[model samples]
Target: MPLAQRVHNLPSYLFAGLEAKATELKQRGVDLIDLGIADPDLPPVDIVKQSLIRHLDDPDAHQYPSSVGDLAVRKAVAGWMQARFGVAIDPAMEICITSGSKEGLANLSRAYAEPGTVVAATDPGYPVYANAGAILNGAGFRALPLTPDNQFMPDLTLAEGARLLYLNYPNNPTGAVADESFYREVAAFADAHPETLVIMDAAYCELSFLPPKPPSLLQFSKNVIEFHSLSKMMNVTGYRIGFAAGQPEAIAALVKIKTQLDSGAPVFIQRAMAEALAAYDGVNPPADAQESHNEYGRRKALLEKGLKDVPGVKQVYPSPATFFVWASVDDDVAFVEHAMEKGVILTPGRGFGEAGEGFIRAAVTTSADRIELALQRLRDE
Candidate 1:
């Protein structure tokens, strides 16, 4: 069997080792609370489900979909951006839907990373961003470290030769949210560095716990590119519906790159997505879903409480949005194993980046019961 040489040097996911250990425990009949991934347990909206079924029968749906998503879905996305973020998006020129935000980020790297380029992303950030850089021998781009002390936002001064700056607010793992002041600073940073491109990973924007909405890059800088996903907010991860909006140049570059990689999403999926957004007005989230957030909040409180006693864990900050709790921990490998052996599965900080080595990302994707259960196990261990 042969594989691409470029992929041979890539490292296995940092969280995989712990997850494998968790799998081993589960094989032995241990109900290991799997909290490593931020995959939501809820189902997508009913309209989305029905739409998929109805479209499944269409012969056109069987063929390859267009490279650019259908007009309806694009319009829906533009509508969402305008209604939610107060930014007007030209569905055709300003927005392009991707299979998922992860793919959007990966290909986005290819679009921006010319030779001798640097890409800035938060430390303890999502792994795909770093992997994107490694693929092209640093030609893809490098991530700048964003630490807990800085409230998980990168200091513009620390970023050097950064052609692309990738950011996620209501961030993954850390669950941090940025205010208008933070965004204003980012805009100012981009203004000072006109040559640089700011890629905003707003995947979790819709899942925010804050009011007045999360600050958007579009609000501040014309050079900024933004990515949004239906995965977390709508519990439609498997559906692979995500989109990006930004300057026409950046958006056009990404769309061109994406076209070469694969065909676009099915028309029915686009229709369904549009329907989901329309139905969003009257949609009532299930109790379990509502409870999911509350439960995570409770677990966050409990974890923070427990952290006070844990030696080597420091710089604990309260998470205001998203479904993750980031904590600085020494010996992530050992800690993850110990917790998993006691029936808990946590993502090691190193999985995100080298800067994440001293930390762990605790996802609230699981139920509060599981969170409580995992915390108890950690406390006992």
Candidate 2:
């Protein structure tokens, strides 16, 4: 049997190795406190559940949904975008409800990238950006390394000639947030290169701890396509619902590709998502919003304080958004292995990219007490 040539080019998945190690440890009876994967421990909001219940009995939900998504769901997304970012989107032309942001992103690459085209991404960033490009046999997958000096922002000079540039603010592993000025700079950069399209991964947009939530790239320029996920916002990772908004042409291209990949997301799930989005006010959300934000804040502080006291551990990038703390250490892989031995699991920065070699990412997805315990174990190690 032979595998696809593209599979040969793909690097080993970062989290799969960590997950396998965790399973091995659990089978051996190790009491492991996993801080590696970013899946929130919180349950989906009540509205999401209630909506699904109401829709599940409808026979319409059992059939294949429109590839572009349910009209009501698309309208709800547009409404949310308008209220949250002050950008008006045409539900029929500018939005595509995806199974999840991850699937949307992968398909976006397929829509735009080709053998002679370049896709630029942050080196110590999401692996999907680079991997998606590779799957298309892209001419070049350029990695703009994020470093301390650049405030973890990818230098645009390196991305010259690239057709797609992937950016994640309130970033995944680093948890770094981008401000208005940075977005304006990116807008100007996009203006200079009209041919390039920016893919802004705003998965963590709703998880900001600071005032003035992260701004949408749509608020800055039309050259950008932004991916939004319900996984982080509504604690609905299992639902696999999200949307891609921006550039009408891009949305159409993605919808065309998705039409062949899978029937749009399940109709019941789409109905549930629609209900959740309609009720959400990003500026003044439901009361439960503060609970998760405050809890993550407390967990982040606890982990940061503990890491500060430990020898050889440095809090290199303290984030104002997201539930992740990126720290610098002597050797990320060794630290990850040692932490696993001590019954604590963390993600190595090197797993993100070469630029992440000296760092480690700890996710605040568990309760504060468990985070404290994980911190204590790491410190004692």
Candidate 3:
């Protein structure tokens, strides 16, 4: 069978491959602390689960969902935007529910990118952004190197004719975030470009621990479209519930492509997502969830402390948000492989981009005890 050229060019997700290897080792009776994946260890509130189960047997929910999502789900998403970011969005025209933010982001790229079109993206970014660009075939993706010097934000001034610019905060692999001034500058840059379509991937927005709640693309430009996923915040990665909100025209283009893919996410899932979003404002993290965050915070602290004494480890700082720590380690691939051999799986930064080489991304998803154990193993190695 002839696979699409785009599929041929896309590499397997680095973290995914690492997790698979860890699983293989575990099956062979090796004890491993699997920290390569960013999946939250918490479950959504019981309310969300109960809501889904109640609708599970509803014959109506068994049918295909509305293409862009049921009106209720879209309204919930818009309400979420307004409540969380103070950004008013039109539920009917400016929002679309996707199976996952990943789908929305990839489809958005396909919708807007054409041959010879240039896209500006950050290095050490979520690889899907670049993958999405490559799949457009005619589009050229230029990775704007992200480094400690610039505080991990891309310098838009360096990008030219950039039709699509991808920004991820609480950034994957790095866990770095930009400030409001940075966002304002990006907004001004977008205004100057006029033609550029900014695609902001805010999957980690709800997971932030910093102030100002991480600026939304809507806070910057109307030309921006952004994605959110329940996979992270609601601990429903398997549910594939996510949404895109912003720019009416961009949402319309994505919806057009979406209609041709699968019917929207399952109706019951959308209903459950609505319930989750509705309660998000007041829903305190369950005791277990709270404990998990504490544990992760401890793990991050441990990593920060340990790296301080490790030779050749540089730019080690605590990320104000997200469940991962990014540190620059010379020979990151070697570092990752060495950790894996010691039963602690880590994702190599190089897997994200060339600039990512010599860096290692460690996920803080495991239990505190396990994290401590992993740290010990890391130090011993």
Best by lDDT: 2
| Full-model lDDT, candidate 3 | 0.79
Query: What is residue 161's positional error in candidate 2, in angstroms?
Result: 0.4
In candidate 2, which residue pairs clash?
A: none
Between prediction 1 and prediction 2, which has the larger TM-score? Answer: 2
Off by over 4 Å in 3: 11-24, 282-295, 309-312
319-371 per-residue lDDT for model 3 (tens digits): 87788888888798778877888888888889999889888888877776787
On TM-score, the stronger of 1 and 3 is: 3
lDDT of 1: 0.73
Error of 2 at 41 (Å): 0.5
Clashes of each: 3, 0, 2
TM-score of each: 0.90, 0.96, 0.92
RMSD of each: 2.8, 1.4, 2.4
* Rank ordering of all candidates by lDDT, starting from the highest: 2, 3, 1
Using TM-score as the measure, what is the rank order of every candidate, best first?
A: 2, 3, 1
Mind giving the per-residue lDDT tens digits that candidate 2 earns over 253-310?
9999999988999999998888887786566555675677777778887777777765
lDDT of 1 by residue, 208-293 (tens): 55365576788777667898887776677899888888788888888798799979876777776776665544223334344545
